[model samples]
Target: EKEVNSMIGRNPDFARRVAIDFSDNLASAKMLIPIPDDFPIMAGEILRVNTGLDIHLDANRRPVVALVGVSLMGVPIPNAWLGNMK
Candidate 1:
């Protein structure tokens, strides 16, 4: 938890711009990905938006667990458009 908080503090822009949620079970969790109407949705965009949640568990007498989920709300493009170059 401390590591996650520290990461959020270090990257304020990422923390503010992304939509994040947490739940006890996968069935109960809901994620909303927003794509602008003006933006084009390519074939692979849906696959990119659908990310997985990682669950880490400890095997000690008293188990400890952590769940991390990241969802990208928009299609990501390269910093420079490939077609733009002559």
Candidate 2:
């Protein structure tokens, strides 16, 4: 974060904030964040995530697998898998 902070110092006014979002062909989830927009957009200004395979047990105790991945402009970003529980 230090690197970004340094960049932010360069532009103290024009830049406003940074944001990250997740989207699929059919839907999108967006999170707007307040950040030093002065931070230079890195060489690769895109982010993406890969969710290779998912395994889960259904109510009947059967395992299921699904092909999954995430992308910001088709590039993969890093992410952690979250489990769903009732």
Candidate 3:
């Protein structure tokens, strides 16, 4: 079974309200968000959305996590696009 990090402060990119549901158990997950307000907007509209977060444990007693990392969000209005269109 895999488990998420309990130390919230350790990974500051996760949201405290977030929780990851794995098979039988639920693991605590947080997004250490750097720019909270802009995240939703910057992530592009055509980009893939993360359904959930998962943590993988290694045999060496190390933990690896996978998260939905996107560079863009939502489509800008036609008027807004015009502003950038030169």
lDDT for each candidate structure: 0.41, 0.42, 0.39
Which candidate do you rate higher for lDDT, 2 or 3? 2
Supply candidate 2's per-residue lDDT for 32: 24
Which candidate leads the pack in lDDT? 2
Query: Tens digit of lDDT per residue, candidate 3, span 22-51?
Result: 552223322233344446664432332223
Per-residue lDDT, model 3, residue 85, is 32
lDDT string, candidate 2, 1-86, tens digits: 35544565476552233322233322222322333546566333433332344446768988765535444545555445332321
By summed lDDT, the worst window of 10 consecutive residues in model 3 runs over 68-77
Clashes of each: 0, 5, 15
- TM-score order of candidates, best first? 1, 3, 2
Q: Each model's TM-score, in the order given?
A: 0.28, 0.24, 0.25
Question: Which residue segments of model 3 deviate by more than 4 Å?
Answer: 1-20, 24-50, 68-86
Question: Distance from true position, residue 55, model 3, in Å?
Answer: 1.0
